[model samples]
Target: MIAPAPGISLGIDIGGTFTDLVLHDPALRRSGSLKILTTHADPVQGILEGTRRLLGEASVEPGEITRVVHATTLFTNALIERKGALTALITTAGFRDILKIGRERRYELFDLMLRPPAPLMPDALRLEVPERVKADGTVVTPLDLAALDAAADQAVAAGAEAIAILFLHSDLHPAHEEQAARRIAARHPGLSVTASHAIVREMREYERGCTASANAYVAPMAGRYLARLGAELAAMGIAGPLLLTLSNGGMTHVEEAIRAPVQLLESGPAAGALAAAYLAGAQEPRILAFDMGGTTAKLSVVEHGEPEVVFGFEAARQARFIEGSGLPIRISTVDLMEIGAGGGSIARRDAIGLLKVGPDSAGSEPGPACYGRGGLEATVTDANLLLGYLDPSRFAGGRLPLDRRAAQAAMARLAAALGITAEAAAWGIHDVVTEAMASAARTHLAERGRDASGFTLVCTGGGGPVHGYHLARKLGIRRVIVPPEAGVASALGLLTAPPRVDRVATLGRRLLAWRAAELEAAFAALEAEARGVLARGGWAEDAPAPERVVDARCVGQGAHMPVTLPPAPWPTDDAALHAMITEAFTAAYQERFRRPPPAVPIDLVHARIVLRGAARPLALPPARRGWEGPATAHQRQILSGGCSAMADIYSRPGLMPGFSARGPALVEESGSTLVIGGKGRFSVLENGNILVELDA
Candidate 1:
């Protein structure tokens, strides 16, 4: 093995179909990347193999790598598949059914048989103890130690591998919950335990309980996976500090990740959004990040060089469009909308003989029929193959050769059912999936009071560029930017992430009767907590100053909006502090609602602080100056605009910065392909990103 070089960073992203890896030397301004089919049985196997290949191809030794950052969808998949450990919940005696009762609001009012997601803990495993804590941190009744012991014993007898403890109003008064946790830990040292107050200190009981239950459910599995991965990497002679990306567009150490795996639910997609923001922020202040992989498509908005952040999101929804149909997790995460439209989404005719695309996919194991992996059903990839949009011999960098005949046969079966030619059926499938994605984009934007026409579309992932032009045209977007190595962009994103942690506390105080010292104390405590977390991740020395935000609302309003506040050492006078807070809140409120409300008393609900560590920026390699070789590598017949045309094919790497191509062209690379519509004009930017301008 060649001696390792210093200062090399390795980033790995595990997707549904592929595990992408990127090894870059920031100082050298160079990079090497690889894509391997994911091993469903053991994801670590794919990660190890891809790592070895990437290091060898880049001519660097494992010891030379200084950092390893990873993002995966494994935990999210476990939640959706219901493959987590047997978990039990321990709560106040009368509030045992809080998980099941939920908010009691029907997500869908008209459906005759509406089914909400089942609680992570069933009734049999939900053991309760006699405890009482009021909403104001007052103890209504003392906790019964004997009752708590009995519940612990019952949970153990029921074969629970993990236990979640949620005492009523514990967010404000955590002493009782802490006492119970210590007792349970002492009795069952082998079991994993999670407490509601430790995870989220907000007001809602149901949401906090759900969050704790989810963390306990996935804790055992995530711990084991991280342990095994760490052992394997150590055995491979890699001495780098392993970091895991969080769903909030930040990275944390392996130990912190194991403690709170729920924060990693959308980690992979968040990385993709962050990467888009970094690459396109200079050219466009506002961008719509569209990432289409093998199993799903994700959309997120990036404004002013940062992705929007949301405090809560749902997972494993029974109905994608309906709220409250899935498990609610209250964690800071990048705001994104995900739909089941991707390359491997299955296509079939409905009961009434109407063609439909998926909310289900033929994942990597039996990937689209074109991969010749025993799949017979027609899928989006099969349709793309029949439409001549994908090269059979070059798929997955030639690691997986696609079978054109198999794709044709699969489409033929669907075409027979539709009573149309295979080509027409293929077009129908393509158009259907494209429209599904566009419609979803429109709805997502509308909900934010924004329109798609105002944002530039930045495309990434394997299927993103292939469908970017059509989706852009549908959304009334005129420009699309496809960065270099777009297929592995998320892995590249992992390289750019900074170490960060967010902490929140409930204040629940009225601004009209507030004290400056009390407010300062609350924010200071949150900053200290955030700093400790960042310190554990090896960012203690140069962590950036904490950013503070407070959730405020009209005294009687049920909800609150987040207001960013200036750093600590606030005004010493109470009246001055109140004026500052009210002014900031009013400004933010007016911007959001388009008008200011009448003079009213406001209350502070929660205080939040974010701690970030500086990460070195990646330099873009200089682009080739001229296109000396033949621009047209070959010609292939493709279906577009309801007709077939001979599209000129070009090699993506061979195109220089000033290279330009008209519509009816295909730009091919190792892992992705860019399809230019008949009326689109494509050009290469200085940074090697391809810009395609759509014709209205």
Candidate 2:
């Protein structure tokens, strides 16, 4: 067994509104955490400030930190805000329109004015060179190196800071794309070069091209930010390697992350899902991991102790719920749904005078009016304050006090506009946002062919616990689990993620025609590449055997289903291996479509391998020795179900395992609050997590 490193391991997650930090001391079995508003202009500023505060409060020295895992939405924000570096794309001749053409499918068919997301690179910057590689890995038209070099020079002269090289069928034969990348990098030493094959080996030229372009677009900015963050940490006397959490719920070295920033698009939300899986999966395998932060609410599913993962996702959509309206990124990501209905989500009357909760957020700069951060608009946070769900004196652990008057004043405007009382308006805002989240969750689960009734809702983030009970009731979920350190759950997730690398290669071939030796070789090659990546990320020892998955589809079908195969050292007999693959595909197809297709030929579309290293077990502070009595810290009047009532307010720290309370009640912790509606019951679990069960 490899001995674990000594000292503290820090996990930092920068969200849309707050930068959360968690410092765990394995030796002492203790953890300290903090949350600070994110600095919009410079995110690192918030990170640095939060880091300093956490360490100081914990009385730990910088040198005591052995490792730091960081996750952020900065790259995603860059893509959404269009603040990334100037970038260009170079592809095979005649494929310059691939980005623009983009599958040519309308996400919304009935809408006459449906608009697709704009390509990262404009037509003028999407230069193409003569290069073509056949689907069978044969070079049809050799790459025009001189022409590529000239085009690269011209792109650089045109102020392209990064260039994405994507040749036709590069997934089948990457030599041309790789050579063009080399030529561009050699000619322009400082320019960032992204080859599609390096980012994704899957087929589908348009998605691959989009992923490569997005990577190149964010590479320069991500690199600069990471470099600056590393230097800053080093200057603070912490010398540990800085790791980054990926959208796929794994940790990789900063170097690897900077090279493919597209993988970091869902980094922050992925961590929250990981945390949910880690903390609640043992008790409930099927869990709805709901995280409501300051700016957004994300819902992911965890089944059988693992979060659901998807091969590709769309980002920065013009229409939030529409699939094809955003940029397609072909990278493995935790499958989740995000909606802008967080605490900082702006709430106001729409043009028709109907109250509307966000898809727009005030964020941290001028957060909710209750935050007293210069924001005049009412938000979910302000509404919560007006409803007495949030205590003005104890918000955010009292690091930032809530202004009750400001909150009331802000909501009063909306109330006046609606001809309702401020409290009534606050309830409307709260109900709208909660319903929005529940609706999104329902849609997400329905799309996966799952129902929310049987799954437990594990809530995290600043607003998650506060709203968990109501959301659970709406979703027909009886139980909701709010883990310890829920407000900083994403940061805690960063600590729980194992070092993993997922790699895939396009392998378009009929199952019956495949050679055992060739198939084995392909799997072996992918495993080797994944292992190399894990080694570079400092997890060389004790890496587990790679898990293999095949993307298979019936011949002539455009879509494919991922089928997990048995562990490696595949059968040597061709018939046995073929049968094994066929059975798995048939079973998966039956499960999804209710029955297997009539006897038909199946083809392997992509071969995937995931290499995972054993994650270090995190030792949370042990639960209190014994349960005390009711332990009511105080009593407060709270509005619930349109009725005002005096509720027992309990301090979370004072409650021990087996301690139970009945609602209406407020369980107060430093960074978060758990609200239990009328007839609801909450109990502290063995792991110090709060499990709230709502009455039917």
Pairs clashing within candidate 2: none
For each candidate in the order shown, give its overall lDDT on alpha carbons.
0.88, 0.90
Supply candidate 2's per-residue lDDT for 160.
93
Off by over 4 Å in 1: 1-6, 625-629
> What's the count of clashing pairs in each model shown?
0, 0
TM-score, cand. 1 vs. native: 0.98
Error in Å for residue 219 of model 1: 0.8
Expressed as tens digits, the lDDT of each residue in 1-696 for candidate 2 is 122375689999999998999999988999999989999888887888888888999999999898899999999989988989899988888888889988889989899998888988767899988888788888788888888988898898899999998888889889888788787888899999999999999888889988999999999999999999999998998887888899999888887888888999999999989999998898897999999999999999999999999999998998998788999998999998999889999988889988999989999989999888799999999988888898888888899999988888999888998888998999999999999999999999999899999999999999999899889988999989999879998899899888889999999889998989999999999999888887777678859788999999998888998999989778899999999999889999999999876698999999999888898778888876543445665788889988998888887877879988789999888889999999699999999999898888
Estimate the lDDT of model 2. 0.90
When summed lDDT is taken over every stretch of 10 residues in candidate 2, the lowest stretch is 624-633
Q: Write the per-residue lDDT of candidate 1 for residues 273-350, one digit (tens) a residue.
A: 988988887788989999999989999999998999988899889999778999999899999999998888999999
RMSD to the hidden true structure, all candidates: 2.2, 1.7
